[model samples]
Target chain A: MKGKPFFSSVVQKLVIGITGLLLCGFVAAHLAGNLLLYSTSDRYAAFNKYATTLHDMTLLPAIEIGLLVLFVVHIGLTLRMQFQSQKARPEGYAVQKSKQGRGALAARNVMHLSGIVVLAFVLLHLADLRFGLRFNEAGLAPAQTVLQVLRDPISAMFYTVGSLLLGYHLFHGFQSSFQSLGFGGERLTRIVKIVGILFSVAIAVGFASLPIWVTLLRK
Target chain B: MSESINVTLKVWRQNGPGEAGRFETYPLENVSTHASFLEMLDILNEKLINTGKMPVAFDSDCREGICGSCGLMIDGQAHGPDRETATCQLHMRRFSDGDTITIEPWRARSFPILKDLVVDRSAFDRIIEAGGYNSINAGNAPDANAILIPKIDAEAAMDAAACIGCGACVAACKNASALLFVSAKVMHFARLPQGKPERETRVARMVAKMDEEGFGSCTNTTECEAACPKGISFSNIVSLRRESMRAQCSGRSTR
Candidate 1:
């Protein structure tokens, strides 16, 4: 087999790893910022203020553009890799069983299955909250906007499910990104895995609780 | 001495590459349990020959398991039931009386079946040719102390070098990825001082060759590690990724 001049599989994996980790960072930061909505004082005044500050920040557009590029590149490369991997095995075995416990079932298939779910959720989330395209309840506070969109049981359910799926995706994607980047040594890998699990749970519970809090307890 | 047991073998039979294959079952009685798996196959072939039927075809050399030539997917596990053992090392004692054993060749896009239980593993050779070696010449045999490699580094390099290129990892992987095999060779050289000169280019070129050979991308399934006969760790793959990233960032490519 002759070497190709283009991006090798290693480079492709690096791209996926870097972009995936960046997205994970964004999710963590976003969840941390959103956690401010649960503050019991002033009816989420701090949350609205935080949103205004973000909107008013001069670098917000640049960050958004960067995020757009990252999302596009990450998803595109992942789909391409998936297609190539599928093509590599034209005929699968009659019986197959996974022998390794390093990765859980959620981690093994998360790239393909949860990826599509997360992508769809991200689009819906952007439309409902960010762009004000679908659930455009104008003149409401940022917290109220969240409440307005999540007031519908179906929307709340979708958000909750999406958040859970995102957790599963991040649970595997976090440490996996590090592995793809060649981060090793027994101690380091163990720590990274523990951190990955914590991060996944935090993001999932944080995001999922927002909709549940607004819909059920915020009466 | 182990007692003999009667058993039936369900072996995959194919006329040639691209031809449809099917399992052909053969029953034998009072087979010695102490015999190696290949020896059992030899006995079966002898019977087939005596019966005026075509004998089964398989590959094996250096029956001691170091040559990396003997391989078969027995009962859905690569290189049979024993852990860290090759097909040549697996004994019939692992089976029980009246057990039905299924054997097939390494199934992968890059490894086409040449006949029953024999596949074309030349893709591994191509990957090695791509960059699995150090091109440097030290001129003469230098003193052993001249290199002064750290103990940890030397051990790690030796561990990576244990890969036998048997392709069991490929057969076991759900995606049929050759990440473990390629990474073992890449890491073996990348960890030593002598491999530094061409390190960056070697990784890039070998990875390109792996992809060109139609091997699937590694999704960190870790199946390859479990199936490896030489116990080549999955960490080699991580090192390969790291080396590949370094190569890309440094803009080094031998292509």
Candidate 2:
């Protein structure tokens, strides 16, 4: 991939698409694991067990590192592509109207902006829950840590907003990655689009349920 | 009787490539709703010339949509408001009396404005010259059914062939990407048997040339398809990405 710029240049767009789809897989898996928080019993038996067992794996650190690399590559490559696109048009039109009509959601035009929102949310989420920057959850089970963070009003609200925007990001990003790879037929493409919408909504709603259950409902 | 409407034209005026551009307003009265957008421009130019002022220079040929020669960013919509209509085909009835219409050239790093509403779209020509052709020997249009093409393949190729080399897709794209235009040409060939010989190299070379022309990469906003006068589907772009990937994985060079 080095020495020959053509190799790098040609695959630049492909890298973003491939990395994005991989990250979508990560998001789905993470959502599944987080749903373990809903398994409440006395002292949260199921949730605590799930957390303890997950951390006990020798492959935990390897998985974490691999996830971090995916984040860096997906985010970094897309930003570079956006900047190049900006340079492609030196001047903008005076009053452009969208022809896609209502199909052009505000999210469609601002993938980068939505991406930034998701990134900030991820950083704050890690701080509030995983790293215990906002709450001292060290030596505690992951489920307990999640509850403590979500029970905080400010943190819970942030999570709700963040999850929604992440959904918005995936709303386009989900099928867009498929389009980027050039995979489609009339029926297959339409199916992918519909499924992408469902997947995006499920991920958003699933994550937001944690905050809603912890801070608002269960309280 | 043809209903006439008065319009205020905010036309972008530039002396040359390096010259500063500004909107010069002209109030055109009694423009027939039956007149095409180019005809309105013609009326405006005539009025300007009669007043001893420099007339705005814009591109127009055949005075109809098929040539793909006339285009403008009228009110910021490529070829004006109507869907699947080029500039020459957009009628004045689309606008109301006393409406202010803004007209400008297609803006892109690869498309330099030559005058008021005319742009140097030779970039399209360059892309075509790259590898948009087949090296297979051809004497004449073969007997109608001699080649035995499948109906679906022929239809898809014809759909792609609708692209008229207009730059509206670029003007309307946020990133000024030429993927829609390039994809149309690529798909036009990819869907047919005659296009099989140089399939891999054709896409590889055209895409390389597209990048060299300083066009941006597609972000899948689908704006190009919406603005396309011929209604070229974004599926062509998807097909193009597949074609490009195949070519690259095969270790084919643009050369």
Give the best candidate by TM-score: 2
**CAPRI class of candidate 2:** medium
For model 2, residues A1-219, the per-residue Cα lDDT tens digits are 123344333367677888899999989988988887777866777778877888799999999898899899988888877887888999888878888786435667888988998899999988876677889945776677777788888888888998999999999898888888788799988998999999999999999888998876766
A1-219 per-residue lDDT for model 1 (tens digits): 343446777678778999999999898889888899888589788898999999899999999999999999998988888888888878776545555644336466656788888888888888888898878756888888887888878778889999988998888888989998899889999999999999989888999998898788876
Kindly list the per-residue Cα lDDT of model 1 for residues B172-221, writing each as its tens digit.
98778899999999889888888888998898778888888999888887
Poorest 10 consecutive residues by lDDT, candidate 1 chain B = B246-255
Cα lDDT of model 2 by residue, B1-255, tens digit: 349999999999998896789999999999999999998989998999999999999998987678888889988889888899999999999899889999989999899988887899999999999889888875689898999889988898999999998899999998899999999999999888889778888998888788888888788899999899999989999898888888777876444
TM-score of each: 0.92, 0.96
Give fnat of each prediction, in order. Answer: 0.62, 0.65
Model 1 whole-model lDDT (C-alpha atoms): 0.87
Model 2 chain A worst lDDT run, 10 consecutive residues: A1-10
